[model samples]
Target: MKKLVLSLFIVLFVFGTSLSQIRPVYAAENDFTFTVGSNGATVTDYKGTDLNVVIPAAYAGTTVTEIGRSAFDTYGTGKPKITSVVIPSSVKVIQTYGFRYTSLTSIDLPDSLLTIGSSAFENNPLTYVEFPDSVTMIGNYSFYMNNLTSIKLSENLKTINGGAFDTNHITKLVIPAGVTKVDSSSFYNNNLTSITVLGNATTFGTGVFAGNPGNLKIFGIANSPVYAYASSNGHTFVDGTVLFQAVVSAKSLLNSHLAGTGVGQVPANTYNDLSAAYHAAMIFVDGIGNATIASDLDNAAIPLTSAISAFNAEIIKAGNPAALVAAITAAQQAMTNHPQGVNVGQTSAANRSTLQNAITAAQQIFNQAGQYLQGELDVAVAQLEMAIDTFEDVIITAGNPTALGAAITAAQQALTDHPAGVNVGQASVGTRTALQTASNAAQQILDNAGNYTQDQLDAAVNQLNTAVQVFNAAVIQAGIPTALGAAISVAQQALTDHPEGTDVGQASAGTRTALQTASNSAQQILDNASNYTQNQLD
Candidate 1:
């Protein structure tokens, strides 16, 4: 008896745990979206042409995964407009071309996300971004055409896809040392005035800066042979050129800075003019690879004094040590030279070579990944085209508008041709108006029931009506796994063709309407729908 009781208790416990795991994931369903699918964490919905979404980390009644694709499509009016958005970390895969043309000012991503899909958030109005260290793969065109004046990338980022932030607002650039390729058009058409590479920057593609000003300044690793092609455009050459400029305007900056690190050191108004001139000179001098005191700090009083005291002393000690060293130390104490550390020293101290090498590596990795996905893309594109063709055939073959139920299968196949990472825009779809016209015609045929015998007329009209209901139900039932399964199959087949290219999936709006028509037809023929209640079955 005791054993049986314990066994029953264990079964109940397991059942409770299973139920807990099956919690519902809510989303703003079909009212605004066309396709909602299972992603890693947050369920994703696609509806708008170019998906625009505002992902709220939490919603009271709505599931946090409520942002739908094409939910903000703008439908030729342009992108959807939004003030700001806070993306949840739970979102791992943001699909390809997602948020392509939206008017969002800013976005903040959470840590849980690992992959940001290709071309995701391509043309947003984001001005500033600070990527988390956890992000490794940055998809193609992820930040292209943004209004970013400044950005701080994560150190561990491995790959950056093509056209990443192509037309940004940054004036100066300091690409890190870990990145490999600074991909083609990655920084094209920007207001870039200065660029300094950190390390051995190699493998730059053709016309990387095709139309930019020839006078643009470029700085790279010392003795680093990369970017020799830059000279072809008459680009200005600086040994270590790129510098990280603050994105924020001076008005937002505090006027004060703590100075002096030792016990006797005192905090000074380091942001004042006194520090300005000193800091300027420190950066002006290209003093790398030399033991001598060559620095931009010659114009700064404090820095010049410090340099004289330090450099001259070292030289003096090896020669006329005693008197010269004492004189230099005294001069520094009197603030004879504007402190060099405040001026040119600040800029020159940074090693541009190391950062450049990093940027190169990251780019290389991204290109490699792209290479892997190329073949996949080719097959997927072809399959998508075929799916559309097949669907059109079905619609044409069913000459009798009342028999339009078969179009649903063709449309489903069309969607399957290219599943995820694809968009069902106007270009890839058939005409919804045709389907609607057919639907109307079929209904008209049913309405003219008095011309035939009771059973014959009823059978014809009932089947026609059922076909219409089925079509309608299909559009409504597109969310159901059964209907979506057939659609995804075509897309998965496309994926196999592109074993080398990236995986992409698409859902067509035209096909969606056709399926809805079939569902509506089926419902009318049956006189009732099993899935919907009386209020909906009608």
Candidate 2:
């Protein structure tokens, strides 16, 4: 009997010890309310209202494994004063109402967290939070009513329950690849500009994106479930291939239309405006590097669209056949009505070269122009021809008159060397008469050279040079005696090769005098050759 009683006592003691491990509500001797469990402790309430709260990793020598329901709530009085929370890695679960109605603006949930219960973070003011990869489940209304601008979902996260992020301030959200299901209202009523899904979720609940802006872009692989979801729900689906093709096609069209001939013929300011518009559109096209359709549109679509529109308008105006014709004709008329004054002989060689180039360029443009512009091109060409003729005529009369003196000198030498009166050898009477007429004309101009104006002297020089050239030709044909012919031929050939008074800077006065002396001796031989016998002439 004594042995049996001791065994029962031992059994009761072991049972009591097992029961002690299950403390449903044991308030630990700490700043927080807690309950002891088999694994560790759970925080039940935050007694203090510190704006920045740091939950203890351990309570009463035991690691805290969870935050109990409503632990950080306002206790039905008002919102908690907590503005931020630092959760230790030891806590694996955040129960319902863990941080609800707190004034928390930021939180760093440790990577040890595995589950976040319903309404765990509802009504906070968090600006940025990164959920660690170990997290697998986000309960209903977990982050509802936050002020989150950026939130990173865990890569290992599998489920986001209803209203998980409802009524937040997120601008951009990227759903992780491991996500399999997103409950209804998961992203409801947020200021989300874009949502990119890296995962092909199997279950997308109704009203998953009910309250977002209409202009929000949904991004995913082209044939992925997320893309199908977006399409079925009438959301704008964006993919890489579509984005590249759309932007490139738009850019190409704009460039081709703007490359028309009329684009350059516009006024300088107008052309600059058109070019700038085209460049702006191209900038948007350049921004579309390896991006999905949603991403490309998010950054550059609107601006590019506006730029393209403006470009189209400008191109249309420029390409108007009637308008182009008017512009071209107006330019031609302007040149004709306000022709640049050419100062004739005073015009520099540079100016002449410029005029020549202008004509060539205009002809090129005319040749390349379509039929509509050719009429105006013809008019411009005619005006240019007139300008050229006027310029040439003035060029001759306006040149320096010093050339006339050289011409007269050459003529006098020719007469003295092979006088027509002395040279009666086999020359024709007509040839002799031509030489006399030429010499007299040259003499008359030389006599009055000083009295002539510079312009008149220039004309006289041209006339005298012609006369001298004629007389030289007649002498050659007349065949003077051998002695006179050789000298005369030398002088005549020199004058022909280097025309009288041309390039005078290179010819010395001594060279000219030598030539004249040869001619004078030649004439003396001719004057006496008639009296010599054939043997003496030979």
Best by lDDT: 2
RMSD of 2: 24.9
lDDT of 1: 0.46
Tens digits of lDDT, candidate 1, 1-538: 9999999999999999999898433333342332334432243433433233445554333334433433343435454444444466655555665556667677776665555666677778889877776666677777888898866665456566667777888666655445566566767777776665544544455555554554566655444544575566576655442211111111112122223422222234432433453344334422222222212212223443443233222221111223323332433332322222322211111222232333344334333432323343334334433433332232211123333334434433433442332122121123333434444554554455333333443455455445434433333221123433344455455444434323354435565455556654644533433444333333
Point out where model 1 deviates above 4 Å.
1-39, 46-80, 225-229, 241-538
Model 2: lDDT equals 0.66
Give the TM-score (vs. native) of candidate 1.
Answer: 0.36
Give the per-residue lDDT of model 2 (tens digit) for 139-209.
Answer: 99999988887787886899999999988877667775568999999988877657766554446888888
Worst ten in a row by lDDT for model 1: 243-252
